[model samples]
Target: MSEWTVHGSRTIYTSPWVELDLVDVEPPGHPRYEHHLVKWAPVAATVLLNDRDEVLLMWRHRFATQTWNWEIPSGIVEAGEDLTVAAAREVLEETGYQIDPRRLVPLAYNQPIGGMSNAEHHVFLGRDAVHVTEPVDAHEADRIEWIPLDRIHEMIDRREIVAGVAVTGLLQLLARRCAY
Candidate 1:
């Protein structure tokens, strides 16, 4: 398939977390038209696994979805922030787990809503994590727990772990584990 030509884009809304834009575009074999584009700042997330075959996760309710689910430590990366550093920082801010940024390895990257949005997710795997303090973003989650990694598949099947980035990271880790 050929790429659609973007003639111009105009911002309809702007916020620190997200933006709405209207773009004039022309498809390869179609007429030109204005399309809605949803945009978000780059997001970074980390799946923190320990030697005990457990993964750090947060139980939280997403207001937009109005559903409770388990999620890995994740947040929007600040403007000009390094993705790896943002991943580590999110872990500490959300779960109070301090992870060495240098120890974080890229695990997965996805534009989950590519059809109408430019939301980028960068997932990292951090195996070396230490609890340093209570969660700084306490309101972000109802509970923070170390969940058995083996139960992840079941949790996901039960709709407990449903965040796209979290699912992507955890599944990628599981896939990697089985590969080795």
Candidate 2:
């Protein structure tokens, strides 16, 4: 068995969303190596489907890439809160659509290979969604629309919705439907 020892570690940066730590480690019979690790909060997202089988999506401009993309409502899981509750809250806050918490389903957990952050995304099929208010986080999204399930593949292929969580949630939904 190979053994590894952590030589040292230092904080590179800290932010509300994430913290970066740089560490030096040595593997058995190998030279020292450096690794940059990111610690992030757990995040949750939802796929809100209405009675018509349309999925609610938000059109937002991601400043990191300076491009607009379609995405589902998602947010960080607050301390001492349940992931299902957070998923329901995100859908309501981001899309102004309220859904029954009982309908929230376990979709999938994802970890972006580029980062160490792992976010558990819960997707749900909302069969009775009603628009009751405007989006709470106006700065996060410019517009919101309901897209048919059939067009999701085309949107993904066209480079419209590139968010990892959104893609995984939608694909899980499709897979579940196919299994039925």
Candidate 3:
């Protein structure tokens, strides 16, 4: 397989969170094709731990998938916002934890769906997260809890921690633990 060249692109739809584009592309040895591309704003997700060493997580039921799972606090990084700031803001808004932006350490990055979407996820680790208030976002989560580290694998095996970014963040933390 060879790289596809985009001759041109036009926005098909635009929203606050996403933009869809129709791109004219030419693949090697093939005629021109119009491909539908979805552009998602960059995302920032955080693995937050309290002083007690328990990881903070949101438990929610996703209507899209009809499943309840544990997830990290995450949100889109607004244009021109620093990734660390976005991570801290998300955690604060979604989980009511005010994490110091300076303490938010980059952990990993990934493209959940690389084929037709341009959504890059930035994951961070926030240690000693402090609770400042109740969740400010009305629709943030069904519940928030601090789960012990040893129970993380149990939750994963039970399919209770299902969000891709959340899973990736925890895996990175677990890997780093092994390294030390």
lDDT values for all models: 0.92, 0.79, 0.90
What ranges in model 2 sit over 4 Å off?
1-8, 27-29, 114-126
Kindly indicate the candidate among 2 and 3 with the higher TM-score: 3
Candidate 1 wrong stretches, greater than 4 Å: 178-180
Error of 3 at 2 (Å): 4.0
Q: Order the candidates by lDDT, highest first.
A: 1, 3, 2
lDDT over C-alpha atoms for residue 127 of model 3: 85
**Could you give me the TM-score of model 1 versus the true structure?**
0.96
Candidate 1 Cα lDDT to native: 0.92
- List of clashing residue pairs for candidate 2: none
lDDT of model 1 at residue 8?
99
Top-scoring candidate (TM-score): 1
Query: What 10-residue stretch in candidate 3 is worst by lDDT?
Result: 171-180
TM-score of 2: 0.87
Q: RMSD in angstroms, all models?
A: 1.2, 2.4, 1.5
Candidate 3, residue 26: Cα displacement in angstroms equals 1.8
Candidate order, TM-score descending = 1, 3, 2
Higher-lDDT candidate of 1 and 2: 1
User: Model 3 residue 37 lDDT?
Assistant: 93
